[model samples]
Target: GAPVTTALDMSQTQALTRAAAVGSAQARAGGDVVPSAPFLIASHGLLGWYWPVSGKLSVLHSGQGIYYGIVPEGDAGGDNAHMPKSLWVVSRPHNVGSNADAKTARRNFLLKVDASPTEDVHVSEGREELAAVPIASVFTHDAYGYANEVLVADTARGDVLRYALDALDGAASGGGRLPEDDEVKDAHVAMHLFTRKDHINTLLAGDSHALALLHSGGPSRAVLFDKECAAQASA
Candidate 1:
């Protein structure tokens, strides 16, 4: 059987043909003028320009859609009154990811510098506590709405444990078993352990609720818990 070929575009006179190889198909579809750099359409529809030489991409317009063509200011006649007169050009694009990575690295460096064996011990103990729980995976969520407070999920036991960022203080204080199970519960922050017959496949957290996916052979059930309700009950 002959390999099938797809015609991308149609011309009124003659059809444009290409070898249909690697990026050749794209080049044919894009026409004669090929864009050398990336042009990203932001969520809010801003036209961006990427300069490969400087590895920078800047927004050229703050409009709500793609910029088709820009006419020169002197060429605008009386009928072009509806067209945009001025465009906002961005000179610099902030590297947000680089800044965030630096902040995280600094915090981790300080934690290691303190040299508290207890911190390592607590993490080990927490993992050991869930050893029999058969956790498929674990993830953390900002359930308590604090920079430091998090809810760590144990998929095996259908448990979501509260983690106070300040737990480092307990490790710094001295040798003692880290808070576990009931002791970790507080009025507004604590673990929400689910009692279900089915195995937990995954966990999802919403703004005010946590969803647990059950691994039943038939239609799986999603258990939802009001974050506040669960916290108050455990507290």
Candidate 2:
């Protein structure tokens, strides 16, 4: 695949979609030499799909009307600055339409996207379904990212969920969501590994590890998880 040298907007997205559609037709007709184009396809409708082309890209969309189609990551230098090294979660706010009811019922959910270091981007197998957790009143702005760790403040649940990137990679193979155990076979439950006070509101990734910030009516504090602590917990 060739590198894209131009900026991509909605217009470009539509054009790419057209091209993919043409290629799909050719493929169905059993034609050889179908033009290969990479896409990070996403759709907000109930029934939408993404092409399984081999490349590094991602698609962000939901049934609530958010669409961020296939796009390359990184800076103009193609350095992948915009890409994620492990999985990252974002609190997504949505109000379907301008209707008063919709506006009044505006809500937020945690959208988790996967990533890897070797590729420009990482996506689930289909890239159609996403790993989402309903977070009614989370600290949307409070998130920490480390090479293989993630911490998110779930104010609604009054606790913080920690994540292990490799575990997520393992889970993605079966589907992007975390497994029923919350802990993958060899990985710990990101949600259960750490415990914090109710309404803990922030997090920051340290230079060598991850730190979670919690706030109560009184003072705010940071909790650092170290190897000894993890080992003790496991034991």
Which number leads on lDDT?
Answer: 2
Residue range 1-235, candidate 1, lDDT tens digits: 2212122223411221333353676665776454543433222334444444445544443332212221111122354343323221111122222223321221110010111112112221111110011111121111221334334443333445544435533342443333223222232243444532344544445576655556545666655566666666665
Model 2, span 1-235: residue lDDT tens: 2211122356755775799999778777855443343333333431122334444443333454443212122232245455433233443343232222322343443344433223344433323344643432333335455556545554444444455555545555565544322433444333323233434555555654444455545665555554334434444
Error of 2 at 42 (Å): 17
Taking every candidate in turn, the Cα RMSD to the unseen true structure, in Å, is 22.7, 16.5
Task: Output the lDDT of residue 62, model 1.
Answer: 38
Superposed model 2: Cα runs more than 4 Å off: 1-59, 62-87, 90-143, 152-161, 174-186, 189-198, 207-209, 223-227, 230-235
Question: Candidate 1, after superposition: displacement of residue 146 in Å?
Answer: 8.0
TM-score of every model? 0.29, 0.39
CA lDDT scores, all candidates in order: 0.33, 0.42
